[model samples]
Target: MANTPLIQTQGLTRNYPGVVALDHVDMDVKAGEVHVLFGENGAGKSTLISLLAGANTPSEGSILVEGKPVSFNSVSDAQAAGIFTVFQEFSLIPTMTVAENMFLGREPGIGPFTNHAEMRRKARALIDQLGFDVPVTAPVAQLSRAQQQMVEIAKAFHGTPKVLILDEPTASLTDREVDHLFKTILKLREQGVAIIYISHRIHEFERIADRVTVLRDGAYVGTTAMDDTDEATLVEMMAGRAIKDIYPEIPHNPAEVLLEIDRLTSRGVRGATLAARRGEVLGMAGLVGSGKSRIFRAVMGLQPTRGGTVTWKGSDITNAPTRDVIGAGIYYLSPDRKSEGLDLAKSSWQNLNIDLMMGREARGAMIRPRALRTTAAGILETVELRESYRPKAVAQLSGGNQQKVLFAKSFGHDADLYIFDEPTVGVDMGTRAALYRLISDIAAAGKAVIVISSDLPEVLNLSHRVLVMAEGRVTAELTGDDRTEDNVLRNFFNETGETV
Candidate 1:
């Protein structure tokens, strides 16, 4: 339980074919400290983590365990050395049960025969110990994102790791689930475990982090005690420049209604009512499973509506095909960017031209690569995505850059209404600023914009009016004097879950 270095890296470096992902970075974690790897996406935090976790070998420099040099050739080696990592992108197999996955590749038993009964009992005990109510026999694919994350954390505890690495542990969690996770972190710290935590949400640091290391563009900036630094200072280090503002002031000039939903009910949503007007930003706030996203998804034909009427500029378009909805000038950018927003295997530029590729704007014209490339480059420039990255596959880019590509894709369709759901979920502060400014610009340009987000500050700051949903319904609507945090949160758990 001594406050000594459990793991240390001296001049660690990692290189891909064309870029130095990590360049001579030095970092360390003490036996019981919650050390944060603070950085924007692509700032080399992941690279450094991959090296420490033994997922990727370092090109140069050395790792020291208890003051002795060692090389980790594989993830098994790192685990053997008492390091366990839960990556941001999940690696859980879809078909496996939670208990089976927890003991995967190392089931308990002698040689070949596995002890199934013991595995189930141990998995249940571990879940109970972690304070997560997950069914051990449930298939991981059937679980929600937050539950899956809990399972990942449970896997780390099963082996009693000396060092634990968590990447964006609360990105998809509800406020209640996040509270549980924080409690778990506090418990682990008391057990003298060294934790390397990564998150874009800086507010969580004040509560848990002992020390923080900042990385900017693949180089180490500095490390400081959490008590000695502020969020602004950390942001400056991560961006390598002073960011005076995070959210831009948006203009609101409400005009005619562009879209309206009357008594909308989908799979998880019920009796939701809302409207989008031109020249304004409509913000929706809710806990997970609250039906905020489902309301919009139903409008786009992705979710079937059991009862509702969607009117587009005075035309009934309820249950319309997604193509017809898009054709009607309503562009919906899904929150799941990897699956619904972009083609990961395609180049950034190609992903940006979904409108043209699907004939939303092509309109039987001959496909011109040069023209598309020129247009895409211009749009990507506005979002601050570098020109060099245009030719690279989006899957190869960092989370922040991939989000920029997804945002840039909306420019292709000159839509009357734009729906951006969790637009800045996993991005850095710099990228978030750019996207916030862009959202403001879209509202100023006389287009109706709807922003659905879990970040309460984002919803309160950007929207002229806010709608709060809980348990498949809209519980409250706030405007002007009613938009304070107290009012919003008070309605988040109203018993009725009915229309305001």
Candidate 2:
């Protein structure tokens, strides 16, 4: 390996009001090496990427490209300098075709019209190069989340960037899709392109990264060769302290059954049966599109069940209206916070207070703004959101912060049965801990909590009893001593009759 750097940053700093996003951080990326920056959410990873992508200018710092210091005025400047970034959010246009999104503003054009044939050919070639099997002519909106992510990658590659920065690239990808991405990344490295990979799953880094860089609280911690560091060490460095156990054990007395779903069937899905006792934390785990989310939507009245019975506290509530479901102290928090869980245009206070503003909670049909503000503040504090962010738009806060606001909204109302679909999807360790504590507290308060996630570790750690679902049916149930990761994976593949 050579000592020459492809990209370098010195004394980088950025501040946002009360928060110091980045503080005098220095980083180096070498040609042909996959360098991973390890940090939790809000650990300056996104801010640093924004700076690299030229989406934001640094308040203080110097960035050097190809061993020469250069100031980037905009994203175009960064692209011209051989830098491309894939952020956590998908950037593809929903209404456009995959080929169209791939080229976008750089589509091939003749003297007066777009050369659609040429554009599609290039798009198909790029997809082939990346080993992605999606059709280039398909509408982007019709593709799954993982396929949309592939289009984002294809877009970055179309720019022919020498240095690629992927932020949480596999957050929404399935296991097979992740393997495909790894293959593409390795090909990029072979071509002498410097790749900066950032992710929460530290274990996956060892598969591709040459060296690992750790950052904590906007400051540089240390960098170590992948061979020299274990997952525990990397986690400790990223967190700035020892977290002996990722999940804190919270004890609760099991009571009578609080929720029962008998033969909960939707079209093309089977009898999805599940139950949760009062004060119980039930975990549902499965692969993507395994009918996990559909079951959740059915319970929340967001989808119509073909045939089933849902009983809450011994009362038949299947196929009930959403408002009636909420009235019965059963509410749901979705995985996609930006879309379903929040109103992006509304203020944080309004998002927090809207539920209360409905019906008589508004004090005889007139919403009490003062009371709403008070209540919002209290809930914001409950989820540990900054007080200053209360008046800002829900879109202004970071992903993890937005999620906190969602949690605050859920807790604002006294819901007995809480269905959290991918509750900690994009959250980091610190925020995730806070979330687990909040869930435990809610359940300890005698409410039933059902957590559905694709992450095995989360299900094993947080669930009192783990139920593995596959093909829209319950495959295996584990409790007490049988909920280990290895055990869960074994059950997942064994019962599903498939290989990982």
> Which predicted model would earn the best lDDT?
1
Q: State the number of backbone clashes in model 1.
A: 0
Tens digit of per-residue lDDT, candidate 2, span 1-500: 55889999999999889879999899999989999988887788988989999999998999999889988889889999999999887788889999999888898999788999999999999898877778999999999777888888888988887899998888877777788889989988999899999887766887899999888888899989998888778878877556655677867677999888887897534787878888889998888767777887887788888898999889999889887887777879989888688998887788878776652352345666787677778778889988877788988887788889889888666777888999988777777878888888888888888899987878888899988777777778889998888777766653453221
How accurate locally, in lDDT, is each candidate? 0.88, 0.83
lDDT of 1 at 420: 95
For model 1, the stretches where C-alpha displacement exceeds 4 angstroms are: 110-112, 138-147, 241-243, 359-370, 496-498
Cα RMSD of predicted structure 2: 3.0
Alpha-carbon TM-score of each model against the true structure:
0.92, 0.92
lDDT of 1 by residue, 1-500 (tens): 56568899999999889999999998889888899998988889899989999999999999987677879999899999999999888888879999999999879985689998899999999888777878999999999777898888888778878899999988877777778778888888899899999998888999899999999888999999999999889988888666568888899899999999999989988898989999999999988788899999999999899997999999999999998898788889888788688999998877888765554453446667888777777888999999888899999888989999988888887788999999999888888888999999999999999999988888998999999998889999999988988988898887585696
